[model samples]
Target: MIQVHAWADLDYDVLVRDMRAVAFDLDNTLASSKQPMSAAMTDRFAELTHRTTVAVITGGRYELVVSQVLDAIGGRADRSRMHLMPTGGSRYYRWHVDDDGCGRWKCVYAHDLSETDRRAAAASVETRARELGLWETRVWGERIEDRGSQLTFSALGQQAPETAKRSWDPDDKKKRMLVAAVSRDLPHLKVRSGGYTSIDISLPGMDKSFAVHELARVLGVEVGGIVFVGDRMNPGGNDYPAAEAGAYAVRVGSPDDTLRFLERLLVRL
Candidate 1:
């Protein structure tokens, strides 16, 4: 079963006591989807970095993380203490200091799908969408994106306004139908709903839990020593696997709620 916490009712001391690192989901947890991080969030995140290592695990591509998240944070946090796991942790990136002492991101490992697998997955998504009548629905931008290790199908288009995206699938009925169709058509790929707008399809064994284990090994820290904060920790949610991986998990409602939780956590730290 998943453990849920209301931001206002959380016990700060208990949650932060043994947490040596904190992991976050990027889109709605850290910032609005496809939007820049806020000034308050940037300052709070920089402060948190001083107390513990930080990692961002998201279904977004590496380029989006750079342009939307890192840029929004203004590069204030120490690169050495930060980790980025994009494509639902199928790709892991870390910072390395070059000869000039400037930091640069390097991919430590990536579970990229083979060319054949990518083509098959893409075809399955397209076919499934049409069969489900999803193609007839109104969309805002690109509906499908191939993020190296993962293929995502956003119902309202990736650039759809937040209001439209949220209203489009408040109950996730449309996306759920799409997921079932895609899963049936492509059993070899892992299909899961990501955030409010998209479904992510990745290779077998490439999920947030895989990323957590890899993060633990690379950082020389036990999985139990980490805390994962995300909005989607329910049974079918993408963040569910991280909780099952044995990290202490906290579920928040929105980016603002996450900020509040982080502020409380900082006080305890």
Candidate 2:
């Protein structure tokens, strides 16, 4: 079992005084479902950028995460203040602005999935899920999302209603149960939560925490010098990895909770 911690309850001031970078998760961490950031939230983030570097490490796809979301948050003073790590710690892409008022996406890293191996893995995962009574899988771009490394089994597939999905297993009861069953057999593979309704199984020893530490390395800072903000850090939760590694973590409810946390962070800066 992963030991859980309430990172917000730590001596947060010590981190603010020493840290040089702030990384966030996208979706519920920074963006709202149907509303853009309020003026106050954007202002607070801009000020935060001046005090420390900023990035958004998410689980969305690169093109969509960047073009649809990161691009919208671009008017900030420093464009380099942001980044997008999506595809379940599989990739990192930096955001840059062009002279013609356009944006550019430069790929920093991505795990190469060999087609031959990936195909074989996908089939194995799908057949297992089906035999276990799970439904069909959802695709993350060209790849099947078996959790992170392989196919996804949403209680209600990708086309399921949003209201239904958010309410289907709000506490993630199903995903956790799925992980337990899968782990019992595939002990060599890693299984964790994906988004809200699926299990992400990476090669043994990979998770969102791996991505957060990598971000710290790229910025030439210690894990102690970074802060990770996300809503779910419990075991099997996506943000659990960041919380486990000792990053100052802020758990938010609504996106407003995230920005409110940022408000306090700005005050410290």
Candidate 3:
């Protein structure tokens, strides 16, 4: 079983010495949800990449990662060491050097939903939302988004301001209820709570654990050799599967806490 530890409880030196790769949850862990990466974080991440492998797995779409994450890092880090698994690990993008020697991200693999499954899942979410009185709630932007491999329902809308999203479901009561309803209505699809305002529905077995195994294969490391850092590693959170898959898990509270953990990890690495 994977153990969850606070950043303070970890022996920084021993932890870094044993790890082969470090994986992170992008949204609230690497950067605030829907926001650009901070300068300090970008620099620290670049430095971290120099020492070992780094990967980011998120429930957001790949386009969102390019705009909010990669663009902010500005290409100084080694792309060979970076792995991007978007759509809650249902899709993976890897850096590739073309024949012309230019580097770019290529889709290594994607567990895309069939049209039939997508339609049914979408309909189920809508029907359940209406049943739960969520359909009448005011939203800030697109509430339902199709991320190829995952269908997302953002209660406050995907583009809602961070403050609004946070205020909408600080305790996750609304989202937990919605998750339960959606799971019951769409038993075939995997439904899990993401960030503060979103629920991710993907094909069965396509959660972060899938991404963890894929990363282990790519990096040539055992599952136990990897470390995962995220804001939501508790039961029912999206990051929980990585822990279930046997990766050493560090559960932080926010982006600032993530940064602090990274800072300490870098010192040891």
Q: Which stretches of candidate 1 lie over 4 Å from their true place?
A: none
Ranking by TM-score: 3, 1, 2
In candidate 1, the residue pairs with backbone N, CA or C atoms under 3 Å apart (3 or more residues apart, or in different chains) clash, namely none
Best by lDDT: 3
| TM-score comparison, 1 vs 2, better candidate | 1
**Which scores higher on lDDT, 1 or 3?**
3
* Residue-pair clashes, model 3: 0
Rank candidates by lDDT, best first. Answer: 3, 1, 2
Tell me the deviation in Å of residue 201 in model 2: 4.0
Which lDDT tens digits does candidate 2 get at residues 61-122?
56546554545556664666665677666777776667897877777776644455455555
Q: Rate the local accuracy (lDDT) of all candidates.
A: 0.85, 0.64, 0.87
lDDT string for model 1 (1-269, tens) is: 55656667877788777778999988889989888778888889888887789999998999988986778676678778899999999998988989998878999888888888778878888888787777746787888888888988887788888888778777878788888888887788888888787899899888888888888888898987778889888877888888889877788888999999998898888
Per-residue C-alpha lDDT of model 3 across residues 1-269, encoded as one tens digit per residue? 55888877889988977899999998888888888889999999988888999999888999988987799887888888999999989999988999999988999889999888888888888888888777746787898898999999887788887788778777778888889998887788889888778899899888889989999998889988889998888887789899999998899988899889988988787
